[model samples]
Target: MKIQLQTLYNEYLNIKWKRGLSPVHTEPFEYGLYEDDSADLFLSGHSEATFTNWMSELRPEDPYYGSKPNGMPVLADIFNQLDVYDELVLYYLLFTLNTTMSIHTHNSYSEMNDWMKNYSFFQLAQLNGLSSLNDEQKGELRDFFFFFYLYTHPVNEETLYACSFREQDLIHTKTNIKLEHYFSAFHDHYSENRDKYGEQFLIAPHEIQACEQLTLELLRIIEGKSPKLSMPSEEGLEAVVDLINNVEQMLQMYAKNRTLVFDVMRNFLADPRTGLYRNHCFTMLLQNYASYILYFNFDEIHALVNDFRDTPAWCGIIINKIFTDAIFIHKIMRKNAIDIREYPNVIEFFDEQAREFCL
Candidate 1:
């Protein structure tokens, strides 16, 4: 199993990513990950630009080569293409919070930094397919993290320097946790940083604690230990569950009444447990919801436009293209000397949202 896992990791390292799609140490905006056309380009599966093509290339031996029915691969199904350990590690590297930052700061660096820093393992487990892994696979994941932390060169400080700060902290903390203390230097470095920054910059304190608890829980489950005393670690797990539930509720409500989405947004943003503000993954999902809702629910324009003001400023900014559509419509109506009142929905929505351009 170890040999096979090593071979898979080697193959993964050898696999090349599409330009601009590769793992980047720089901010998402600086690298164009959040460009207006990114989602469209990704959904369209153009050449090597989309994840679908990337995964298809990964599993060339398969008959279908990882193509899904929609031609766009879902996050969960992406894991099914790889060995359990491979998925676990790669997912962590790709999505987990990394402390590395560009020395050159972008204007919205703090905003994007919050997103990057708070994209923790708990969220990844829910967003990725780890939550759906079978018991055997779960055991393998647990054992992989355990043995890999101890026996592997991950503990070497020199090697860790190349890793993101979050991964390095996890290794050091795990070593001390196992009472091995093999990486005291790393632990001391983590301590100094935590003191300076209030916690490890790479991984939040709660998340680090959660990861430890999760591993212990997995060990107990593998050993047939059924129920145990309640621990604070479960809070992190519950946070992920709450996030998934809130997203589902928001999406369902959005389909019925676009206006109701504002209420959902208020509740989600106000509730600290959802962590939507800090989490890049969830914030992007909300922005996506707003994007489509704006175009498809123009009939509910008055309510939608009015309620959107109550959402975070960033929400409106992220979907600024919707405002562009309003501008185009208003211009056309004015050019024909059309009575804007005849189009009450558009006029009212435009007046409320883009009042400066209203004729």
Candidate 2:
């Protein structure tokens, strides 16, 4: 992917060079009061003239100011030297900064506005002639920018520490098996069948019964109705038990207090510094997963999921992972139990799954 991205970037640069439109250096100017506030405000109105003015305003005394050349020509030249992944990281960092600044500025002044309708990073990129990216590259870029935004924003870090039990819900929904049972069965099935089957397996009656018995024992341990399993540590029984307990706790919390779920989620999702843009955008995405436990608008859940999955952000990465995992687990279950036929190897299975499930 990095190699492909580099090739695409080179092609883009070649197009620019052939047109004799390489970025040029200009004299610096004073940017006035815009420097005191969000840089997005200045950048939104950016022209070669504005960029020059903004660069001129940089002061030696400013703690954040570095000695790197601030002109576009110099910056473009620097970009040419970076590896594709490094270039993406640098571009996404800038994107997050601008997005954060823009969201903060919008929230301060517009008490009731739909910023999503007004703002878009994709549009901004296209306007700047940055349209060389393929869908996969765009997804990676969104994920990178989102994580950058999430970690940098000022919120109680603890709010972000919740166990993501959505994966369990996904497994249950897709496979029609409880998560505990699924994991136990999957572990046993993988151990016994992996080498023999080479990605194709048939379920014997004994294997099914053994899996059921193991699942029951796991449930007993998780429920505190029995002592810990005596299995070898390599089997990861302890880790499975821990996961079950954490997910159980999360479910209990959701069942006991719906408002608490929203409140904690709001702390993570509602912050303007994270660039969710609109209140509804946050509410919509939260509703997709939260609505399974809480009573909220259900009509838009699929649309919301699609929206989040399409957007290039941390939320999208998360949604994609959750659904992708569910699909993978479902495939595994089908292969081991029901299919009873030779299937595509694991790599092919994943490639097919990615095409079906991922953005």
Candidate 3:
């Protein structure tokens, strides 16, 4: 069944490519179904009105009602004649089309609001054939959805509030309900199944260990300890860099209030690094501590002691070192403030220090 679905999907993509309608080559800004004539090929003889009508049915209260079908009727009928997996594939394709194209249209705002209000994550999952998936396949799908939500959803309250109020009263209420409730439900579902699904659902064990080692290396650099270093994968390095950037941004934003800075720091540090390098947490700790020294006033440094006490023993020691030695703090901050640019420079710096140590 999976093989058949894959074949159909490949065929669909091949057809699109042949017709010069492949999404891969097109700019995302050029992806609207209503705006792009090439997107008509995706409808497979069904009219744009037909697709809209189908979407409208997903939320019966949709403001733009149409006479079209709910699922892609042509493809649905073809796949329905085969196995349920085929139908699932068709639905998945439809869902992708809706997300990638139709949702970009001006008219789609109300339609999307209505649909999100009417459907739970699980219901949408089921509609897309997720219920029939094996545990391994389900885990992969979960990762896709989790990252999609993480990257696409508004990260801050202000943006979320703006999205909540973007349209008509009916849509405003529905959109808020969907965005607010979806993540809670997604977290609950993944949390319950995480153990049974195993570590493959996130980062592999070796990546986690590498991340941990990388964390220690970053901490040593921040502390002026000149520890021996082994290079981590590019992905691990990037994750560490991203953590540093996030911490620096946070510190810059909340530099005025020491308490609020620590609060924000703690919240970011406490988040699980699911699908990230194991040392991700450690990198965050080092970055936050570094940012603290860079941004916080010496007089207000005493407030950080309480916060450090709540962290790991190692983190506590690092925090204490920054608080106690003014000269050491200045030296560390000066060298560490050089922004990490190319990864090879970091590797070379460590390599140079190793030869001096041996001598």
Candidate 4:
């Protein structure tokens, strides 16, 4: 029997959040297995006591877990166990479910957050089995994943990383998969979605360019390799502020190298001799960038606020902005269930600034 991939995918989505199918772990990088009954989430309208049982009839041996014990099922041999269509359904479920259940993250650096690693592990597993497919099957599989990535993930979040992973997967697996084979189809898919869905389907190019430029300059200054930077133009300043205002864009920028950017900003704010702090435009940029520093590294920001030294009175504006951002980020982190121990006690820092700035 031929199985339609989209129909199977829709069916999986329906049962993915059913009572017994939810993942057992919610912590970052600590993805555990779904409940035993989750096997039915992909069992083509059938149910099984466990994922292993669901696959027992299809494979010659028991499915083994990958790097993470008891995390997700991995079959070493998928060459001839199932028909081509069923294999597509199986691979789709493996990839989509792994991404959905893992801790949601924007960081592409696996060392900082292994959420991508967890998702890519199963992805490589699926790619390893692609050697058995013909050109048509390979094209279908690529489109299946490309469409899903666009459908579920926002462009400002994981889109770039997803694109990177697909390219890297080819190298890692050494399969005959031709990325160019699907480029036209992928663009058409995105265009169709954009046409149907409107602005939510778009990425603002100007905002991205501004973020890239600002991030590069900040990185240069922190490394003591100044680029003879000039103050941003009035419009440039507005673009920078716009990038900061959009949390998803800010996250996309930070995911490049969060720790390095945090360190750069922390050092920049701590030193009083940084002449840029004297320029009105530079000062505004500093104030806005500090907000992101606080958003990403509350602990370091807390220390920066506490370690303030004697400086020009105008520096108070930067301090005030930091304090305000701390309050805002604290509430945001709490609302999103982000576990940041430094957030609760941050009010004291803002309180001190409130008095000093007479706000």
lDDT score of residue 9 within candidate 4:
27
Which pairs clash in model 2?
142-312
- Predicted model with the maximum TM-score: 1
Model 1 alpha-carbon drift over 4 Å, by segment: 1-107, 117-123, 128-245, 266-285, 288-359
**lDDT of model 1 at residue 220?**
31
Q: Cα deviation of 320 in candidate 4 (Å)?
A: 6.0
| Ranking 3 against 4 by lDDT, winner | 4
Question: Which number leads on lDDT?
Answer: 4
lDDT of candidate 4 over 1-359, digit per residue (tens): 22222232223322332323343321111122345423232222223222212223222122233342332222213222333333333333323332332333234333112322222221222322333344454444344333333344323222222332342232112223222222222223334444453443232333222222322332222222332222222332444433322433444555574443344444445546423212332333343344334433445544444434333242354555544422333333553466544344343434464544333
| lDDT accuracy of residue 61 in candidate 3 | 27
TM-score of 2: 0.20
TM-score of 4: 0.22
Cα-based lDDT for every prediction: 0.32, 0.30, 0.32, 0.33
TM-score of each: 0.25, 0.20, 0.21, 0.22
Better of 1 and 2 by TM-score: 1
Q: Which ten residues in a row have the lowest lDDT in candidate 3?
A: 163-172
Clashing pairs in 4: none
10 residues in a row with least lDDT, candidate 2: 121-130
Report, for all candidates in order, the number of backbone clashes: 0, 1, 3, 0
Clashing pairs in 3: 54-69, 211-279, 212-279
